[model samples]
Target: MDKLGIYAVPAIIAAIVVFGAVKRIDLFEAFREGAKEGISSLISIAPSLIGLVIAVNMLSASGFFDIAAALLSPVCNAIGFPAELLPLGLIRPVSGSGSFAVLSSVLEKYGPDSIIGKTASVMAGSTETTFYAVAVYYGSVGIRKTRWTIPCALAADLTGMLFAVWTVRLFS
Candidate 1:
């Protein structure tokens, strides 16, 4: 089974090459065209993505999230939310990488089997990077006025993070 996994990708690639040859399609040209389209899409989305990433990094570096987490910790803890997991929950919607860094820190400090770590992991898996997705997909298509999309997506992300805490507590 382990060997099967190793060979699967090569087998798939070989099959594709043979199929392309049989159909007399120019595989190299097809690959180049696909790459071109991908690059064009990247170019369209890059500016918004870069700005989002920079903003996230700036907020993180300025300790804004840390302060926010500290301020919200009491409210969170009263409702059975782990005070330590507040940062991960707060950042998960805005930036995937930022939330991942928070998750990693949680795992390191609390260990993976600990309730805080488990909740962080679950939240990371359950929530989407709402701002990142809005910036990428919406910006790619040139949609500037995301009136309701941001609000709705953020609400969904908050729901997911809350459920992650509840589910982990329930199962653990």
Candidate 2:
């Protein structure tokens, strides 16, 4: 059953493609149109994504992120998360790629089997990409008031980090 689950979506897609081809329904043209639309949408959102990347990089390089992690360290320690993961928690809510890079660095520095690595991995799984969320929501609605979203998302990420650490400790 699990194996079938892996193949199910592809199987359905393959069935549709075969059927469409056999029925002479211009399937290739339809797919090309869909691809073109996807490209256009991606292009439309390119500026927002670039701004997100630049803002994240500036925050990280300006030492604000380190300061934030330091400020949160005590509370994080109280919640069972290592002080080291505090920075990752801060970044996770703001940038998925940045968070992933932090997670990878943590894993490299403190092997995957280590408590910190496991907790970070679990946190990654439990947390949502917050900045991406804001970008999509605001971009869709044309709302520019992003001031509140970051704090709200960071709170959620912190909760997820605490939960992940606690749960991992229990099961490991």
Best candidate per TM-score, number? 1
Every candidate's lDDT: 0.80, 0.78
Judge candidate 1 against the unseen true structure and give its global Cα lDDT, from 0 to 1: 0.80
**What are the runs in model 2 whose C-alpha is more than 4 Å off?**
1-75, 145-152
Error of 1 at 1 (Å): 26
Q: What would the per-residue lDDT of candidate 1 be over residues 22-115, giving only the tens digit for each residue? A: 9999999998999999999888766766666676567667877678878988897788777778777777887666676667666876899788
Task: Estimate candidate 2's alpha-carbon lDDT, on a 0 to 1 scale.
Answer: 0.78
Could you tell me the lDDT of residue 38 within candidate 1? 100
lDDT of 2 by residue, 117-170 (tens): 888888887888887888998999999988777788778777788888777788
- Return the TM-score for candidate 2, rounded to 2 decimals: 0.55
Can you tell me which runs of candidate 1 are displaced by over 4 Å?
Answer: 1-71
Clashing pairs for model 1 are none
Candidate 1 worst ten-residue window by lDDT: 48-57
